[model samples]
Target: MHKFHLSIAALAGASVIALAAPVQAQDTAAQAPDAANSDIIVTAQRKQEKVTEVPISITVANQAQLERQQVNTMNDLNRIAPSLEIQQAPGQNTGGGGSIRGIGTQTFSAGAVASVGVVVDQVSQGNANISDLFDVSRIEVLKGPQGTLFGLTTSAGVINITTNAPDFHAFSARVRGELSDAGTAGSKFGNQVLQGVVNLPLASNAAIRVSGVANMRQGVNRNLTTGDLNDNDRYGVRARLLWEPADKLTVNLIGDYARARAENGGDFFTFIKTSTGVGSEIANCGLVAREGNQNYCTSQSYVGHTENYGGSLQIDYQAEPFTLTSITALRRSTETGYSAASNVFRADPLALQVANGPVNRHLSLFTQEFRISSPSDQFFEYTAGAFYSRQKQTRDPETLSVMLTLFPGMTIPLVDPATTGAGANDKIVDESLAFFGQGTFHLSPGLRLIAGGRYTTDRLSLDRYNYATAVASNTVLNVGNFSWKLGAQYDLARNAMVYATASRGFKGGQIATPSAPAVPFVVLPEIPTAYEAGLKTTLFGGWVADLSLFYQKIKDFQAQQCTVDSNSVISCVQRNIDGVKSRGAEINFFGKVFDGLSLNTGFIYAKATYPTGFVGTDGTVIGGTQLAYAPKYKFTLSGEYEVPVTSRFNGFLAVDTVWKSRIRYEANSRSETTFRPHWLVGGRIGVRTEDDRYSLSVFGRNLFNVHEPSLIQSDFPFGGAANIGAIYGPQSFRQVGLSFDAKF
Candidate 1:
């Protein structure tokens, strides 16, 4: 079937399932109803507000929903939010990124800036690290441009995470642990997690909170050489302090540290022979192995380790009708890893012996911001802010080694003292300054107008040195840009609001490292303009629904291309495309269907394509093709039921299912690297004490053992005859687990 038709079928199926649930009559005799679908508070606009009151297309998940859904990491969010997708890069061990609304970074270069920004407690991070999700209170996903309010400029959207704050009048502690098995022979303790949090009142007006987590898991894939692959061992801790010296003055300090050491599931190859006379040297290897079977056959190991630490300070002061705030932060991250190159050379005789060397990277960043805002109750409320940030990154030297096994007992090195052990030392530094302001004017009692603008200046520098020849290259770039938003909103009724907005977002110009010395070193920035209209409504007293439609056009979209020269040396380059267009519609509904039953459903339909004149890396015309990782239709349906088991205990059950259409992994739209439509189901059943202090539950994820590939890559055209294979990462297998929680 055509891809478009498949998308339509999937959407139809999801709609039927969502609307067919029998709506049970409300039971007045039931106990206190479940509050899971109650009004949720979100900070999408840099201020607290009910999610139903926000004009943007936003999704908010609280602690209760997160626990019931078993969402432990950022990657798990795709199951609930259909507009987002996350995947690991094909060949790299420490380079993976995500996309929002069909727009994101296509390359894994350290110098490439992300279209989506991730913020934690008002502090922006350079990368989308999953460790920051530990012990989070709530997560809010905002769709569309957000440059006018946030310190970081994002063309796609923003993810805002808020952690629990210290309470001066409370002393509490909580602990939770989980243990799971993969339901396969030779697989023991597939997953384990232990987490704890403590809150204490140090003085009359001062308080402190601390949180820690330890997570470990065994691999889903078994390596023929090594025992297991894709294992995870991670630990993290966070501390926060709050002090209120006066009624109008408040200060907060936060620090966090996280470390991970594990073996990454590097790319596994499946051979594809283009020529018919190539003998039995190539065979069809499924992207994902069947149940109870290993997928990859390799001789070398792929391992990675990472360390991250950060701290931030915030101060707020209230003066009459205005408030002033300041935030200062610093962070550092280091990663080291290596992946074998044998997967790309499956057709050669010495394919199993080649391997790439270790890769090391370090990043350090500092940021500061100051802001002032008028009270929200005023007729003309306004906010203004200034931001400054500096970042430095370094890539350590790397080495490539080849092993020769001529005669079992005798082997010699085929090495040239100088060029055989070549490496590159690269460094990048960036500094940015921006000033932004937003204001809302009440045109009338039921109508409002909003306008905002931001101006940013960025300075970037790059230095590269070759160890073999002592050759060096240096480049610098400076650019300035402006972005703005215009919006209007109207209150139609007591429980309905409609809004429309048009916004522009910008990304800084980048310094591209080209293989050819004659090419320029700089690629201009990309800008996107988006127009959106949305409606939010609360119906039937407890049912909330939202609908949004958006259209975006991006100019000078960045694209990466690779070519093989006459000497068979591959050279990759980055350039700007003419333009791209994306239009989509999102629908969300959440509320209590009956006294003890709640339902949450989300659906997304998007069509993202490139304009005419777009070219692929292998000289193929890719005009009118779908963007990478952009699916046409996606949907999620989740339902939960809560009932009283006893006077002091409550029993609850939750089940959720997610479905996504086929997605292309590369711009060329090759069929071999496309992820077909798939579905996943998860559920939990448990009982908890009436006081909510103690609980136990049994849960299962991927209950049907679906074999789907998360990412797929084809190296047939880029590597010529030497590399003609496909690599992919399969989804996790079925897992069943039990969890225990306690509070004091």
Candidate 2:
């Protein structure tokens, strides 16, 4: 806690230093004319427009900035955007534990969908969302309800990712490699990354671009029982082809495959406390982690693997008065292996062994979209689109309980007993269709009125069979909703804009297949009504600043709640809460203050909670409780400065820091499920050529070795005192490495 307090002071000092440098920077402004570009083109509105000119709150990070900050995964992104939090829950290969403005899906059910959508290129992702940020052009984070333009999943917001397209005019290739070590703190060359991109010019009007990446890292936590934990290896390759079949038509074809494997690392387990007694565990948490061993299983090795592959095609044609576009995509994601953390909730385990049988899951998705747009220059500008999506999911039976043990008085692992047959198979299919449109009516040269809406229909079916009881469950549910937006934006000046909007967003109802006979097969959809106001402006040379305030109320909020019956049987499913409220303010600033110094900062003050008058069947009081993963306040700051050394080379330094208030992993506000406020800091120092053709740098992450978890849970099945389970962040330990980059 002291360290966290010190970090705040440190960041305050840094800000003071930054405030003091502008005066000196003004004197050297003439010598450093290459400042930041204040105006950046974006597709926030489904059409191209300057980011600051848009009426929504947004944060943009380009490839150079991402690489400079060493942001390679979803968790790393949370530090750059205060309003976003990516939690990779243990044993889950897919990216589902993510929230925008403290609203997201937290269930581990294979069929559950996230409220915050992730869009790659122009294709919306289902269960196959990519986990690695490899070879991307830029990322745009849009806050607030984007359902009118993004579709059913984006009730809260959207993470829009656009990769580099094939450059028909260029034939070039480049490769980058990085290696880092933490000595006794970590493995030798514990983290390594290699990635490359190649552009091939084919016919006169056609080209293809291929990019691939391989990243391997050793787990920072040690399993005092045996070897290190959470060792991971991931690799993937992406290929895109751009072809202009005719003078007025363009086509893009894309395909990619990626795979990740890890040992007892899929879940973060640190010893928080044990139900048994004190001095009993040094490190214990996450379902029941014991001292000295993160996974702490002696029976069978814990391992898991996840694979994702997909293909998409996009065609665009320019007509006389409008543009026509079509997008089609198919994606499949699979996970197979045993997850120790997954089973710990069903039984009191003497050691770590998730299930009696290997856990396997498969997800398939198909999407089609068509859109038409008129030029933005028109007085009445408009965009309209139709979208269709289908998803199929299946999970193999997992043996949740067994009597197998390695020792007499100790439960080391699982081995199914012949006397009992336990497990079940789950299958689900979901389909959705929607039509959406948005338009702007120009009232005058400096003012415009905007309106948009989406009409969607959804259907879901599920089948689950229990082996022991021979009980089968078959269910189907259908739902429909319409969401809309009303707003107005005004240009205060050439470099400033102000806007206010009232919007309604919808998240489709949820369906799940329980172990045997499903009690609640469907959950009603959630509807959020929101009012927001914001201002975007440019100041101090090329610096850009934005301030926004919002309030939202949601009815029938969906959340995952679990229970254990008297028979020692656990039933986990999606449940709808009475009401949810979110109100907050945000500030974002990015760009150069002057000369060679640049700063990027984002802060969020959000109060997300469930209102009073709501009680649980288990007698758990949750009235006025904050939602899980929703921190009351968060702040992120990063800065970089360039020092001119000579005509041929220059030296530079960069630093970043993130601080978040205390958060609970469960909406019930349980005492055991809490992560104290914490801070993370990173730095880099390097030398580069004046023309920027080549450069080398030394970087360090988690400079303070802050060990903090992104998620926490109660040891549900335990009998003694309250026990906590936690999964730490990706950069939980200190790591320093060397990096090299070249362009030719």
Candidate 3:
């Protein structure tokens, strides 16, 4: 395997280098200029500049890269970015976790927060509600801490994706089709999709661009008894309008909706009692049983429909070297489906059973921001902004319970209402206001300094009332904090620069758990400080390389702890008790190595540890443990070559690989073994027309058929000790499919 990987790497490198070689033939006099020499522009610092000239560590995947690499969603981006990871929930209530540099939340709760922030066209996507894949122009990932420009939510940096804009000079249309085969564990899962887009010029200065997509995929699992269905069909669509009435103002109205009615049928675990038979090993909050079936796991399924609609109005006006902009946006989402596990009935064969049910949630938000920036002069460049937002989220009724039959001599124990209660609902309201300013100053011809700070005020109110259980509570809290950043850069040569920076970042304090009537309660807020140094260089006018090392310390880290009280109502305690220290290094390189070829690679080494304490399910304190879902080492490399076939036809081939060390789930606080280490390799072969007007391509992903589970666990007893009943979807297997894309 080592030799195989080395050979592939060598071939890819050679191909890329060949792409950059000067053309030797005058045969086709009609050939276009080499694409590699075009200047790449980016907006990493809230301003447009050459990508290679940006001081911060950044990665950009433009439209050409996306089309060549076949990147469609967050998951595709994950496979290529060594510093990032994305995973769906394993089963019900499993937290959806994404990690960057070994730091992130590992909870499936709607209220949980993610470590890295995702921003779409300047708007922060606070949650996964808007995570659907879409047609985009570019994706930019700024590594390390992003306090000065992105704010507190960016303690672990930021991912910004920008979509294509309407063109007034061109009237065009395109269509695409895809057929895919995926899954592992000897299962057959198929996926199909169709997409189309049109750009129309309504008038000289106004245009409209609209796109729609429909996709369907089948799951690998099947119900034992029903034989009916478990994992099956899912689909969605998006319509957008971009209107520019004048040169200074633009309005974009977007409406997109997605629905999945397929069986949520994923893998899950059942509990087995310890030798003492005092407690079960399962971690779910509650359990229930239906008919007589000894230890048979209950069937799990998912059925839900979600709708997302929003509008962004942006106004930009420039006067001399100063520019002012205003942005207004709104988003709303509602999801209703089951949020329970089926392990209860599977573990207790004699226990009465209950079918799965719904866990409904609705969220609404409105945000506005105004900013002014002055173009860089001989002396200074400055940017200042003010932002405000209002959000509301509601969770309706999450309940489960069971009735057990006892032996003749055994007595039935009384159950707590908190555990089997009905009409349990949660409501949260969040409002924030902030003002920030940053400036860059050139002290000498080759030296630059930057300083910035932000002051923010946040307020939150939460209410949880279980009407049927007669339990209710409400709380409100307000917090104010100031974060700052400072950096200095010195150029060592025309194509190389060295820099050092220090920044303070934070995550907003969360609402206290309403039902936890503890001795002393407070909102858990996270304050992290980061220090970093790095080198940026451009080689051969084609390759861009960046290397950075960083250390971050977080105080009062917020995490959820499940505590079983005598009343049986599991208390979700939120506390600001623990502290975490993290350190890591990252290296990124992208360039053309040869004629008609491109290469991109990244490496990351990160480690995170809890310095204070973490609470266990049994109410025991565990100290000095590693955080879950974070790998210690990760790397990725990809390269592609384009081959000319005819004046109207072109062909291309590409290979990409990712490798990472093992990661622990549940923060390794529990004694369970949940995951293993793995590596993945994929390749693509396709052809496109010279003008890029019409194309047909065949591609294969996960060519090695590796079972690199994104999430794993060892608590399901049905599969036995060594097996521990793992609940994971096979990442993807060797798939060969042909795609057709046309433009008119």
Candidate 4:
């Protein structure tokens, strides 16, 4: 039987889809003819440029569009952006599993850098809490390798986020309140959210804007063992100040602090039964019943906490023939979690503990960048900059493993400890310095040539400590590399352009965490070469379509190799895989059909394949064809339709749909490791006054209540006989909520 979750949101969405008739323009979109073609300003190339004019594949999601999509955090963008995919990889932080165009960081080590650059306000968010997307001006998704302009972390791409600037001449205030399924039986987070912003005009040249959010929502997964909801509470606030003393100089100061506390380290719904069967998945394990967020655990939950704070100062001075800019930032974050808890299962009558222990990580990073650029619109435009950053890992993770009781010779012979947990005390310091420059030469009135290069050097040191043995060790690593790119663009017409580019990107090596008397593992740098061609055109008056074809090859791919002993104890080390290749094409379109309707669409067809060469624990070479957790195709659509119903009231509806191909969950391309493809539909409809001061709406997502597990893998030593895997897909259920917004 196939049916959607029968909720209020579905009833509203059905009416909207019927009336809007194929569209994604947000409700707040201006009722103007150029709604779809409204030029979105972006900083993809380290400079402000129209999305259609830039020589890169980009996706822009503004505030109005974001609200219509019901975007709450970074992962929410997956529904609207084709290039961004948030996979829930095991043993990684929240943002670590994010991938762009099938390439992303999938490691449990702090030494490894992300393939996508998570940048906020021109500052890198190494370990910062960037979940809060409210008050943001726009989020730009730049596809393909961008190492030359962004940091080495951007071998795949970048998520550039810009916040709203303070208004210098106006005092403003706004508030948003959301109440969704608040305490609805076993399906409630008491999900009440209150967000407010205020801007004050200080002096004649300085203005400050501040915003804060208090979300009383948490995990909705109810644990049968403990009768408690696995909850993760998040709260944060940020402030920004803008000062313009003169016409030639501008200064912006920004600061933010955020913290989150999660129950059982956010493992509440992660280890539910894999199948939707009527009985237990494992024989004698009566704890197993149904699937989805419902879970049955033998052990109780634990607490996981995280705190993040950061600030940045940006100064821009325009002088002579060139503009000078500098940005400096400092950030720190700390996270704690108990990894091996609450997932233990014991088919036997006795419920002894299998493993228990706490692991913690701390980070402090500082970065500075200075650049000089020729004025825009020049025949010979150029920009040069130097970047420096230092990151310190003060407290590395610690682990303690307990022995597992093995029940051998029985019909089912898998270890099921009903038991007890690691303490590795390692610290690391990494410093990097780089010099980069790019030039765009207008060869003719309609032709341009582009070239850029960056030279980077890194020095790292580590301190390893073994408390049980009272011994300490030190290790050091140093490396240098260069990234460069060359490209050309031809103006086919006033609003259309064609471009081609070839580039080599570099990501620094990794020095694994300390593991005692043994030497620390060091994985060398990852080098990637990319070739791309693209077309950006505007036709049918205001329809803008952008297309790109790209092929990227990565060498010395970094990977985490782990092994589980007979005791079911897992240990991991960083390793370098042979290579991987990803080739794909993307299309993004936005246009206005009429004053009341607008359309936006995004699509991607990428094949990220891993070659056949991974060294197994047994020293045998094992490889897979497709990249784990990466889908070959993805399509998304969004739009808005607004029609005035009365002299003082307006009716509007917005809708979005996302469809993704099936994906493999692990390194091996076995049938059991694959999952079926799925599609999602979401939308919101509401009415507002013509003054645009107040508005209300009904919103919902995953309306079908589709049970799609973001990850599926064999719990090898636990699931006797068939090793019938475990399931975990956070926020997979249907959600319907009411939201209200007001402005003054």
Q: Which candidate ranks first by lDDT, i.e. highest?
A: 2
Compute the lDDT for candidate 3. Answer: 0.60
Per-residue lDDT of model 3, residues 1-744, tens digit only = 232234335434534543454433111101212233544567778777666666777776666566556665465777657777776553222112455676655443434455577777777656534544556667787765565676326766777777666666656555565555533222244455556566666777766667665555443333433433244343455555667676765666555556554454333332222221213321122222111111223344455455555666666777557888787777776666654242223333333333334667787778788889897765798889998877788887755443444653453433423454344678878788889888889999889998988888988777777655566777777889888889998989887889888888767767654332332235566788888888988866767787989898888866655333443233445656456877889998876656687888899888777675665543456566556667788888888888899888899888878887876655335444434566777666788888766677776666666545444443322222232323333244344565666555
Give lDDT for model 2: 0.72
Candidate 1 on 629-693: residue-level lDDT in tens? 78888898777898999999999898878888887756664565566787888788999887676
Q: Give the worst 10-residue stretch by lDDT in candidate 3.
A: 25-34
Q: Write the per-residue lDDT of candidate 2 for residues 47-115, one digit (tens) a residue.
A: 767778899999877666677788777767887788888877664423445687887777756666777
In candidate 4, what are the lDDT values of residues 392-491, reduced to their tens digit? 8766435444443333432321332221123456788888999998889999988999999999998878787655456677877798988898999999
Residue 634 Cα positional deviation in candidate 2, in Å, after optimal superposition: 0.4
Using lDDT, rank the candidates from best to worst: 2, 4, 1, 3
| Among all candidates shown, the one with the greatest TM-score | 2
Better of 1 and 3 by lDDT: 1
**Model 3 bad stretches (over 4 Å):** 1-37, 90-97, 108-110, 181-187, 226-236, 239-244, 247-255, 265-302, 340-356, 403-419, 512-521, 561-574, 612-625, 669-672, 713-726, 730-736
Predicted candidate 3, C-alpha RMSD: 8.5
| Deviation in Å, model 2, residue 31 alpha carbon | 25
Q: Candidate 1, clashing residue pairs? A: none
Candidate 2 wrongly placed segments (more than 4 Å): 1-37, 91-95, 182-189, 276-299, 340-356, 404-421, 517-520, 562-571, 616-620, 716-721
| Model 4 CA lDDT for position 75 | 63
